[model samples]
Target: MRNVMILLLGLALCFLAACGANESTQGNNGSGEVEGQDEAEPAQNDLDYPQKPISMIVPFSAGGGTDATARALAAASEPYLGESIGIVNTTGGGGAVGMSEGINSTPDGHTITMVTVELTTLPHLGLAQFTYEDFKPVAQINFDPNVIAVPADSPYETIEDLVKDAKDNPGAIRVSNSGTGSIWHIAAASVEQATGAEFSHVPFEGSAPAITAALGNNVEAVSASPPEILSYVESGDLRPLAVLAEERSDALPDTPTFAELGIDATIVGCPRGIMVPKDTPDEIVEFLEEAFMKGAQEAEFVEYMETNGLGLVVGNAEEFGEVLAESHNFFAELIPQMDLN
Candidate 1:
């Protein structure tokens, strides 16, 4: 009887030891820690993305078309993103300064930049060292077709009349653009290319200033978007001669397009979009694309765009990337021909 009791006690002790070992192993695995050691923290991927507010850098001064677009987009996207998107303008170097800041930001998808058509031309003009390839496109929000406008009292009644004057007086008629390498400037260059005329090109800091200069009669005409001069056109302060688009704009349907006039000037406009660092995770990029796309389709956003005379051109990351590549290639070929380089 004594031998039997001793054997039973030994068996009970073994069972207890097994239970303790099992518990210890489970605790170590669950807490990711060993006995008498600290626990390991979770990995970065385990955390929610956009854990903080996003910063959207606009490489232009306030009140410009790009700034307006950025504000509109940020306002619209904040609801969908569940966080605020702050717009920070770091102007200078014809967008180079802000662009560099955006490009050099941490690639964690928290910082993005509002890119314009200038991304395709600035590098070719020796004004920037980076191109569209340097950033990963997130979404394309708006596109505004360039319009040729003159002061309401100008003698030129039609686009043909303006072209005739330009040809007759080469480098005499002064034409103003937003900046030397801006999309507005490219529009003027396209006009010069198609009509084989030479007009003295003047550069301003932005579209607002360029249009103001034209309204004040400082320049013979202004190459800018219809929206930029909408108030002036409505108030009889400016007369729009032509729209450099393949089709007429809804905002200014009465204005003729360069295509209808047999001019081969197409694709002269500003395309506004968002871009992030190229190394951002695909999942994060996808999330942003979906969120921004939803924001773009929101009714308030559409109304704002229409009211402001800006066209809503929404595209996801892949589509935007394709557009960027095409624009870059087009400029790469056209810049040399226009001697802009």
Candidate 2:
């Protein structure tokens, strides 16, 4: 009986030891699985970022330069983004309404805005409560330089002729711009600063109307993009005197730049780019930058810009941010000096 009891106790002890070992192994396996799951969670989250469609807001009406560029970019980026990008035109307040909507978006990378050079000027003009700094830049798609254009039958055939006439008769040469505190207005002001000439700056609702005013001989000249006046120039209704760029545009190879004409303003006209709300996630911004950069380089997009006389300036987020900062600084000083505010 003593031997039987001893054997029973030994069996119980062995069983307990085996059970404890199995429990320890199971606990370790569970902990290992949990650690592995934790490691994968972040990567899964990263991949899940843009799980829906995106909305791109254009602040101008359809058929304008901003709208055209926005559409091109959205189309080109859709394939790479694995989702469709819908363009929404929220035109008003000189682009303030659309920009405000973009700024006030959820910052989840679904909502973005096509920003223009007006972004730098609108705040100074009291047209918007936000500036370029209010949003995070994604990429710069285009930079169409402002062109000094006049009626086809105008006597001012060149920049020199226009400046000479304007200098001789300060505030007499009527130069029409898109609006009072618009990018074209700043271009007109820069022309005056460079040549010591004064133009009777006439404000229109937009570039189309301003160009129309010049074409109808209501204004002596129109400061606008090459694309804005390309058809007219081709149709012999308008003559481009000079482009406000450091170099000549391929779209207008015959047209000289401001630098060629001894004018020093290198950057002018409307620079259109993409941006999201400032607090958007860095990962999302990076993804968008990559996608848009790829989109800007697409053959179809390049061909469209070239055919339309639009300047192609492809840049990533950091480079775009730098350009925006420079533009902001330039306009900040120029606006005050020109009394645009």
Instruction: Candidate 1: list runs displaced more than 4 Å.
Output: 1-47
Candidate 1 per-residue C-alpha lDDT over 135-230 given as tens digits, one digit per residue, 9 for 90 to 100:
999987776778999999999999999999999988888888777787778778888887887888888767777788888999999988878888
Model 1 lowest lDDT segment of ten: 3-12
Which pairs clash in the backbone of model 1? Answer: none
| Residue 225's lDDT in candidate 2 | 84
TM-score of candidate 1 against the unseen true structure? 0.82
The segments of candidate 2 whose C-alpha lies over 4 angstroms from its true place after superposition are 1-52, 264-269
Pick out the ten consecutive residues of candidate 2 with the lowest summed lDDT.
Answer: 34-43
C-alpha root-mean-square deviation, candidate 2: 22.1
